[model samples]
Target: MRALIAVATAATLAVASPLLAATLGDDGLHKTDWMRDTFKDLREDLAEANAEGKRLVIFFEQRGCVYCTKMHEEVFPEPVLSDYIEENYFVVQMNLHGDTEVTDLDGEALSEKAAARKWGILFTPTILFLPEEVPEGQSVSQAAVSVMPGAFALGTTLDMFTWVNEKRYELDGDEDFQRYHARMIQERDNGKTD
Candidate 1:
């Protein structure tokens, strides 16, 4: 009976452990099952995301980033946030200072580092949420519907993800992200979390 109980406990822990811990890759970035490994081609990635019924999201991160670590350890591990991201976004991670080749939506080929520079990204953990139908002749950066810079608390981060996923940017109104996030916070506190 003791051995059987021990085996059951071990099985439970094995299933529960990932929810409590986020894995780090050799490249010093958080490794999640939802993040895609692709050829770093934005056009192809966008098409793939559209076909999957998901939005394209580009994540920029650097090695040894404390904010990235915080996001992976705290915000992203939350079940609600993680499940939402996995369901709505096709995420592609780019190293802020690495030499991986990338093809932009406008056919500009550059290294990952160069692409980050071209997009004016100056921080770690920058997330670019893209529209489904990008206008021709524009780069991915130019076509991005929203850019989330720096780490945020779970609520704000989740709200931003939810906003971009729901195409709230296209809605005709003056409720920008700040107002939308505030409304979401109010709603969540009122037991309306979604």
Candidate 2:
């Protein structure tokens, strides 16, 4: 009887331990004060970023988008990527199909998902890097200057991250971002560090 009781106790603890670990890990992943979970809040966060002199990185994603899940699970959790993002950007997560009210910087209330449509955010996991503030009287309907759609590998993602961090878009003119990106790849392969 004593042996049986001990075995049962051990089995219960083994199952409970995994459950406790999973809950703790989830709690840790969501333990940031500035992480916005909705599109509306994310738009508002852009203004906060502008006020704080931080760049805005808006991640537009849709339900059932495998690439979006991959980005969230793989890219965002990467230690180096997370560190860079936390240091340089105000990150915003937006659901492409959810209906929610979003207040723009100008205090206009619009459907958050509708605004995404107006901005041509048709793809899942589109990342927009906003370096400058939208002008006071300007509209959010304007297209982002830099948009990267689809999933990206860590190397490509890191390259883009560095380029945006250093403001290379200002120097590379008329070649388009893809061409500039290619140049970066070449330079990197040649052991050139920028």
lDDT of 2 at 150: 84
What would the TM-score be for candidate 1 when compared with the true structure?
0.92
lDDT of 1 at 193: 49
TM-scores, all candidates, are 0.92, 0.69
TM-score of 2: 0.69
Q: Give each model's whole-structure lDDT.
A: 0.91, 0.65
After best superposition, candidate 1 residue 109: deviation in angstroms? 0.9
Task: Give candidate 1 misplaced runs (Cα > 4 Å).
Answer: 1-3, 11-18, 191-194
> Residue by residue across 1-194, what tens digits does model 2's lDDT show?
99999999999998675211101122122223335454454456776787777787776666667786666666666666666777777776666775667665455676758767766788887877776656664455452557778899765787777778677777846755667667776777573432
- Model 2 alpha-carbon drift over 4 Å, by segment: 1-34, 37-44, 105-107, 141-143, 172-176, 187-194
The superposed Cα distance between candidate 1 and the true structure at residue 106, in angstroms, equals: 0.5
Per-residue lDDT for 91 in model 1? 95
- State which candidate has the highest lDDT: 1
Clashing residue pairs in candidate 1 (N, C-alpha, C atoms within 3 angstroms): none
RMSD of 1: 2.4
